[model samples]
Target: MSKLIDPIASVEDDTKSPVSVPSSPKDSPRTPIVALKHKHEDKPLSRSSSLLDMLHLKDVHIPTPPAVKFAPLNVPRHRRLQTAVVATWAFMIPICLTVFYGSLIFSKWLRPLAVAYAIWFVLFDRAWVHRGGRRQEWIRRSAFWKNFAAYYPITTVKEADLPADGKYVFGYHPHGIISMGAACTFATESTGFSELFPGVVCHLLTLDANFWIPFYRDILMGMGLSSVSKRSCRSILKMGRSICIVIGGASESLYAYPGTNDLTLKKRLGFIKIAIREGASLVPVYGFGENDIYELLPNEKGTMTYRFQKWFQSTFGFTVPLFHGRSVFTYNYGLMPYRRPVTVVVGSPIAVKQIDKPTDEEVQAVHKEYIEALQALWDKYKDKYAKDRKSELKLVD
Candidate 1:
């Protein structure tokens, strides 16, 4: 049996991150090992190495010796702490911004409008940033680090174990409240994505409606985000290096209650079918804390929230992912999740032999294997991140 690895605690659980410069192996005690099976025919691949090799994916390494001289905000701990503060500070934005403009638009009488504006940003603006006018390349990159600093900080634990030449389909599970961590970590070159996982380029997939947002549309394109539409998936898989999809989307968001591992996925198979057609290896990813950040209203099947979301989906083709966190004054920790740690483990890849469109059984079989891969990832890393988890993982229908 392969023993699982708890990424967070396995390494220094409380160690602060090193910023800017990458560390040489000598400065660090633990280094990225290369015991992977590169010999192909002659030798068997080491579990981690061989798995990564098969999918054309690579593990990330956390730089050590803390590059203090080159970076000011380089420490990973600061990144985590500051991220919460920023989310809280963003609450102050409408006050400052509105005060600046309200005086002009409404004069001395409507000064409180600034607060209203900030509330608007929190309640409405954050679902996804698709505003139509701004230049987003900078935001995509900066947003990458901003989020990295805010939530779970990750590094490629090892080198790329896959062939330098190949294509892939990366399936990210447990679509956290926003799948925001996935966005910052994989979709863009920011947060050292390429530095961590080289050889394969990743395209983060999202809703087709997102393309309608003005500025956000430009931003996502630059980050290489594509539509989650089946046609788009086929095109992306054919394009080849790599592409990522949240797999369980809006519907998944409804099951965001804490202490549970219900994945609002089972019937969703367009991405999997696309993968079979493209002949790409399937990679399973599970992010701990994806669901723990906020307390969502109970939206069970017959609840008003659930009914509304379903109606909304039928009418708009998109369902409302209802969740709640904090509001500046009302929430001390705020809707912004507290500083609990979130770790995203990239599981070993499940290789797919070339084949035609998969049959129902074939799809179910692949999905079953995919679920196992995801379960293994959880089993391996759970103790580290979810040591306090109330119950073992479960696959809720």
Candidate 2:
């Protein structure tokens, strides 16, 4: 009986034993000393297998640096000089004029002289509408004007030879932030406008308000830039002289973004009418890369910023472009335009019939033909000139 009891007790103990033993040596949760000894014994073989596997696998690629194409040259001096020249025209001149006027207020020697000049400009100076202030020979051939155009390295390409005695009206497109092309090609003969179209003088027209600024007015008059007023256009055309009008005024400059060809000219018929009335031949001038010189901040329609700009244009008769370009120290930031080429292509002239008072239909007909000519210019040279364009020519009013 005692032996039977002992056998039952041993069975109970076996039932109570833990069933936590690992099924295989490799499946063990913890590394025992015995497992370590076996692993060390197989280490040499494992390393040999790894080496063979590596030899059989694909090769790992190690990239090399690209080779330099061209050697660098000294461009900093020219770039800095170009920036200074541009800045002087855009900002320094205006600021300096203000300072000069303030000095006149404090100086007894210059006060009377400044006052007399101001009075003369307001009451007697006929440069705004008449050709009295244009010293064509001196202004066109001046070294200062030459340097101004050379800063951008601007060039004019004449598609066809304009008739020497032909009275003409040049309609400049894209009204770049400042219409630098118009200034270079027409305002100054720096791009050799006289040599290109001999005996065909062009007077570049701008806003009348521009002529109101002190000292700056004299500069504008020297460059032969008159007002875009009806009287000015009529007077210049009646004299058998050509006039270059930046038709896409200040409002168009808002769309003047880099890598874009947008013109606010769909509804602009005033210039067309002027051409018809004066019997002046219409010439379309397109400046490639004019808008690419600077970048304008985005001002989408309906946004507050856009509305404010529109309001400002309506109130002040002029608008501003929130624009920027490269710098002297870096190609990243500043007001200096990038060293991009500006090729002003002067298209073939479109002859307009003389109408003392052109009807809307007549004006529209001329405008349509002008637009077609402008489009042809873009289509012909876009690939060659504007290969980096983000979009094609769009007449966005």
Compared with the true structure, all predictions reach lDDT values of: 0.62, 0.79
Question: Over 4 Å off in model 2, which ranges?
Answer: 1-77
Model 1, range 1-397, lDDT digits (tens) per residue?
Answer: 2343323312222344322222567765676444333333334343333344444333433333222222234457755455654464444444444545755477756556645654564466532323211324565566535555454443322212544466677777678677755766676544566665667666787886765543345456666677776666666666555777887787777776766667866677776777777888888877777777676767888978889998888798767666666432333324555445556666667787667857998888888888877787888778877777767776665
For residues 1-397, write the lDDT of model 2, one tens digit per residue.
Answer: 1121111111113333332435566777675332111222332122223332334322333344333233134667665566667767768566858866886878898888888888998899887687724656686677766666777778899999999999999999889888888889998888999899999978899998888788788877887889899998998888888899999999999998888998999999899999999999999999998998887988998988899999999999999778877665556467767667788999999999999988888889999999999999889888988889999999998
Cα error, candidate 2, residue 284 (Å): 0.5
Give the clashing pairs for model 2: none
Name the lDDT value of residue 74 in candidate 1. 46
Which candidate number has the best lDDT?
Answer: 2
Number of backbone collisions per candidate: 15, 0
Estimated TM-score for each candidate: 0.63, 0.78
